[model samples]
Target: MLKLNYLFHNENLAEMIVKNWSYDPESTEMFRYYRISSNAIYPFRKDGRTQLLRFAPVQEKNKSNIEAELAFIKYLRENEYGVLVAVKSNRGEELAEIRTPWGVYYASAFVRVPGSAINQTDLADEIIFSHGHALGELHRLSSKYEPEPGAPRRWSYIDVLDWIDDQIKEYANAAIARSEVQLLREHFADLPVHTRNYGLIHYDFEYDNVFYDHEAKRCYAIDFDDAMYHWYAMDIEQALDSLQDCISEELYNHKKHCFLEGYRTAFDLPEDPDAVFPALRRFANLYSYARLLRSVAEKWDHEPEWMQHLRTKFEQSMRSKSTLFGTKLS
Candidate 1:
């Protein structure tokens, strides 16, 4: 019943969905939709407010996962975290289900955060410190979070490892990838997980996902689509990994101090944070490779030249063990 070829390219269907949210299709400017994983992202504006529209195929995200994501966003908003808030549809539904001839898709809208994404050139100590503090606050809050019974839980590290196992089974370098997975599992098994150190975290808490308002001195987080349950230390390491290109040895030491200083103000951190870096970096790289594999496997037959180039680059990175985190691999 569904037309696979026209699924993502259905502009008329997209416009209809947008209109369901009480926005005029004629007045609203729908930005081009691009693929992020299996989802399609469409950013648009109406009535002086910028909004983001997201669509995920049923195969990508189930109804429970979508509801859980929205619930988490509501929780963050209730706690006063500067996260993009989900918008309700005309029927007071936070999520919209669209059944098209091409298949079913889940749709959600969010009010765009004010300000631009933080860039490498503007990586000041204060901004970095504040970024750490924001994450610390989120962790602190997550430590006490208890979802209602039967609510969807985010993917665990084990779940990701299992996914990697399935993805790399036929990869050219399956043996090496399997070894990395085993090592990561061993490392994670040794890491302590307690109330203070383990919780749901914004797995993609990178500069691009954070919008900095200079006037307000605030960093608003967006894109919680990748939030997951993990060690708080992993979140910290992920944040630093995102800044590797912007930091030199001397600058890293200073920024690390400042960042940790701000973080400590909100929640307690481990004394030897750097000791955990090597393992976490490996974990990050493995996940990155898995993601690249997923993308390539899903679209290889119809992939654009640029996507093919990206796959090549990712394969090189995996082989060299060189990633955004740093040159050294553990």
Candidate 2:
């Protein structure tokens, strides 16, 4: 579990940040702070435009990680990808360091992407297809990406699993969690990796992370904080999981088919993309379990009602070993 007490949760600190960045404190029209996992995101209005301020503890996100993330964003922008661009500070740095009573935090700003989140609307085939196409473009570009010599490398799948293993070891279902992780490791070990098949990817390419401009029929991606080195198929699986609660299976399948078709236009996937779902689903479950444990360990003493509800949901999912696509893990 990562510590989050150092977050810029108050207006005073938020105002200080605004001034520190040479932005007009009086021009701040709206400001809010929220947390997702260990990261603190501050979305605010200034200069008649919306912008996002994100910060994380140094231990959770070091300088190298920040540079890597910003570099990837810049690369994507240079390649004409629709992404939220990072804004340089007054000091001409993409990332800035802020010290508070709790700890040190690394902060960065991004220009707000135009349009609204796709999650606010019904799932349309065109939107789904566009999502797939955009991700495919990212994969194609990532296939050729080369980080600077000392840039932080994206975390491998095994790295995430090992982190989760550490989290679940103290839980009541430790053995079950460990076994599931081991099975996933075995399955992943058998998969082939090549430039065309593996590279950095937007691992969380779900609706909320993407914005849709209905008029322009374009999709813009934001929040590359979770981007990592993984198989291209994993991004597809995660996108499908985001649509798990569609009205019916028929509509879901139709949307998925459209998405895959769009993806194939840019890069070839496995003959049966569905074959990778089981392993990815198991990984998602383990990841969720690990997050639940970490959240509890960090915030259980001050847990809110929503957090408790989420804990209940995670516990049930873990006990059943349920996959996102309506299958039970053996």
Candidate 3:
């Protein structure tokens, strides 16, 4: 979530971003805050078409990261993969930077995908199948993608593990979390890597980042913010992680079977993808624990009521995951 101070002053900066894109003036009137975590997103109608403006503080994201993200999106589009395309500003820039007294903010715009997001309650089999196929197709394309010269590259999974260690090392549970991080780093180091089984991955390929177009019978993926270099099976594991909480084990097993079946249609699978999931789940847990800790650790004078409630929720989650990791590692 955005800090209280930034939220208060975001309106003027948002207007500046819209104008830089040369969007219709009415877009400013339609601007509505959509999300606040990791990035601040606003959805608005641009000439009667829905679009989104996303910006993040330099501390969270930098100009080079945004440029690399858009470049990958362009590559995916060129390869006929279904993904959101970035919108260029009037200055012919895919990413725009605004200097502020608080900090530098990088902004980018994208055409809002034209489909409803799927959730746990009403996830149909067809959507589940297409979800797997969509990720598989992306991995296939990623294997062949080479960034243009002088373009920034996405971070590797090990780089993120190092980051999580640095960010959370001072917290109460840092020792246990750091041990798990070391174990994960060593395990991945020993694993074999090849273009076919490892490449760029959508680190958060869950239902929220994907949309199903009913008429077209396809899935469009958004939010490449967490894209990174990792094993392809790690993507499948992350996509299936949420199902464990909401469904019976039998049903989860059935869904996994269906998902992998669809995945095989687009990309070849590792010989034992199932065996790799337990370690990957540990990685996922540690990463989420670090992010929640950071959110709860920030200081705000006169914090909002919602933030208090959110902080309580985050604390509960932190304790739960901390115990879970301690048990798994021990």
Q: Which is the better candidate, 1 or 3, if ranked by TM-score?
A: 3
Name the top lDDT candidate.
Answer: 3
> Residue 149 deviation, candidate 1, in Å?
2.1
> What is the TM-score (0 to 1) of candidate 1?
0.86
Clashing pairs in 2: none
lDDT of 2 by residue, 108-178 (tens): 88888887777876668888788788888888999999988877776778888888788778776467667
The 0-to-1 C-alpha lDDT of every candidate, in the order given, reads: 0.74, 0.74, 0.79
Tell me the tens digit of each residue's lDDT in model 1 across 1-330: 011232235566566667658664554445554444445666666676778777766766657766877888888889998889888888788898878765777888889897777763377888888888888888898898878898877777887888778877886656767777877777689888888988888888888888777888877888877777788888899888777756787788788778788788789996577888778777877777666665555443675666567667755765556233222344
- Give per-residue CA lDDT, model 3, range 75-161, as digits (tens): 998887888878887888888887765578788889987676756326777888888899889899988988899889888898889
**Candidate 1: lDDT of 310?**
62
Query: What TM-score does each of the candidates earn?
Result: 0.86, 0.87, 0.92
Q: CA RMSD for every model?
A: 4.1, 3.3, 2.3
The reply for model 1, stretches above 4 Å from the true place, is: 1-13, 27-30, 33-38, 170-172, 247-250, 298-304, 320-330
lDDT of 1: 0.74
RMSD value for candidate 1 = 4.1
Candidate order (TM-score): 3, 2, 1
What is candidate 2's TM-score against the reference? 0.87
